[model samples]
Target: MQPIRVLLADDHPLFRSGLKNVLQADPAFNIIGEASRGDEALLLARGCKPDLVIMDVSMPVMDGIECTRQLKEHDPSIKVLMLSTYSDDAYWQESMEAGASGYVLKRAVDTELIIAIRAVMEGERYIYPTLLGGFHKPGGKAAADELQEEVLSPREQEVLLLIALGHTQQEIAEQLAVSIKTVDSYKTRIREKLNLTKRSDMVRYALKHNIISDKTV
Candidate 1:
């Protein structure tokens, strides 16, 4: 399959360079252009017509949300996945309202950016798991937090997250620096704690709770 064409838009040259490096490291992406301002991004998008854009929220001339709105108006098929330092609900809402296909936090980008990109390119709406809990208050964040402390121990959560990421028990053992039998024990406890019977069910639970969508995954 052809790599996904991308355009990087950020005000900082160093940050833009970092973005370029990350995407380049992944063979699934092809860098076509770079921009330092939202207006410049819009202009470049019109010219290159990339498959997706990794957009920074704050930019000169125009902000990412406005650029996203304009970009969607100009071509709804062009996907925009927001990359921002801001984690506020207002920004998230605004970006979504402006037609951004996904919103990813900058702090988590090194690990979560590719996951967010894969989701947006495949037509799935995504949010950085760090921000997911805030919106679904009373249930989302609270339940996940409760699970971390009360239900699943931190190491077990680590094991569960790896499982959700499609890692085998042996791989998890190597990564976690433990024996395969120990990894098996952790996995068994995680499944039993969640009352899950199948690996698929665990994956679904991990996804629904935003476990697989964050930094590690």
Candidate 2:
């Protein structure tokens, strides 16, 4: 059988190296390329034409979400499996929306990652098992019903995620290219919608709802 051509995309050199080593141990996988940023990943993907890309959700220059979207547009057949430190359901949903074939948490065991890769390679969608507590599948109706109740705007969801990730308001604003006041407004709206009274409450809510994993807090 032909080895699976794989591309690694992550900002952290050590993480990429570790992933490369892990995949190299499996003869079924071939490490075709490595990229340190989203744009680099895109360029390499076009050049190498890897069968799959294991990409970090957060990256400099362009985020993995936008990169995955562009990759799918350029070549729908190339699969993308998002790897992230966050176990946030919002990130998982956004990744799917951006055309990722699978979502796996960074903290997942090597076996789980391999399972996800194989599942995606076989043309099946995969979501980390821990993140699917109340749902039968990646985008199940239970999740949709919960989303209806929250009704957070995309920007608000972004803000809430950053907050749960322990980013200060200023950092969130900087990352989103918005002012601190705008971040605060988003926070206020999120709190009001969820009836949260404190930052800790928001963090708790994020964890309880799988908006973020416990490790993130």
Candidate 3:
């Protein structure tokens, strides 16, 4: 199988070097090129046509969000995984709107970054679990206000909570003492009942309904 071609984009040289080193150690990834600015990244991307671009949110010339927008516009097939220090929901929302396939925080990069990259490469969107906490304000009424009247079964609620807490289908099955196929069925039912098609949307719903507390996970 061909290695996943990747382009690194970050203004900081040291950080870029560190990321390149880490990615290089993984045989699945190939460092096709590196860019120190968003504009440079755009130019390099056009030339290298990498399968993925690991980009910093903040950069000179143009920000990662704008660069991602332009890159997607130029070639919709290119995947972008945003690496950022920011945990703000606004930044997360903006990155998603700008066509990011995944968002991983700098703090959790060592542990979660590779998982996020693989998830996106496999055609699944990846959002850092820590950032999901921002969807609900502490002691605020936003979550209560947004809560839906539709009720879920006990098993479905348990599955939803686990999913929102970042459990994989296999893990959830193991935890709940159910089969993987059963977990998938529960997820499908949850999505249909809530009218949610994206994992992020289900996460938000879980928060709003107090199914999963930010502090708990």
Candidate 4:
């Protein structure tokens, strides 16, 4: 059988390197290309036409969930397996809604990623379902389920996260490669949708809703 053609997208160079080494050691997989951000991943996927893309859930320019949505919209045949350090149910639910074939935490890569890859290649949705054991749990399960009421666009969530992280609008514009005006537009939409204005309110909303955890993405 032909090796499974694979592309990898992760912001951390050390982690990406480690993953490369892992896949390279196995003959069942073929390393095609690597990307450090979601947008770059899309470009590489289009060019290399990899059968599967190992995507990081968080990334600059474009988050992996948004990328996966766009990829599947562009070509439903391409497979995307989200890899993240987060074990939150909201994250996994959002990823599956965005058309990801599977979701796996970075911590579980050693034991479950290959299994996830195999499952996804065989047309199965895979999620390790790690329980959220480290959260503050302000409102418990209902807070997470409230995600069904309203949803933030992936870009809006990205901007909101940057805002919660104390990044200036100018900094966010620079990182997203858009004008400050565009960044403002995204912020306005986010604020309007969530009815959150203060940075602290945004942070609390993100936490209570499980859009973000205390851990770094």
In candidate 2, where is summed lDDT lowest over 10 consecutive residues? 129-138
> What do the candidate models score in CA lDDT, each in turn?
0.81, 0.82, 0.82, 0.80
What lDDT does candidate 2 reach at residue 99?
A: 99
Please list all clashing residue pairs in model 1, or write none if there are none: none
TM per prediction: 0.66, 0.63, 0.66, 0.61
Worst 10-residue stretch by lDDT in candidate 3? 142-151
Question: Where in model 3 is the C-alpha error above 4 Å?
Answer: 136-217
Per-residue lDDT tens digits for candidate 4, residues 18-89, read: 999999999999999999999999888988999999999999999999999998898899999999997877
lDDT of 2 by residue, 30-147 (tens): 9999999999999999999999999999999999999999999999999999999887668988999999988888987464687578668967676665565433345676555464
Error of 3 at 37 (Å): 0.3
lDDT of 1 by residue, 1-217 (tens): 9999999999999989998998899898999999999999999999999999999999999999999999999999999999899999899879989999888888877866875676588676766654644544457656755633443545667788889888998899999887787787667556545667787887877887767764544
For model 4 the TM-score comes to 0.61
| Stretches > 4 Å off in candidate 1 | 136-217
Model 1 TM-score on a 0 to 1 scale: 0.66
Alpha carbon lDDT at 118, candidate 2: 65
Q: What is the lDDT for 53 in model 1?
A: 91
What are the runs in model 2 whose C-alpha is more than 4 Å off? 134-217
The candidate, 2 or 3, that scores higher on lDDT is 3
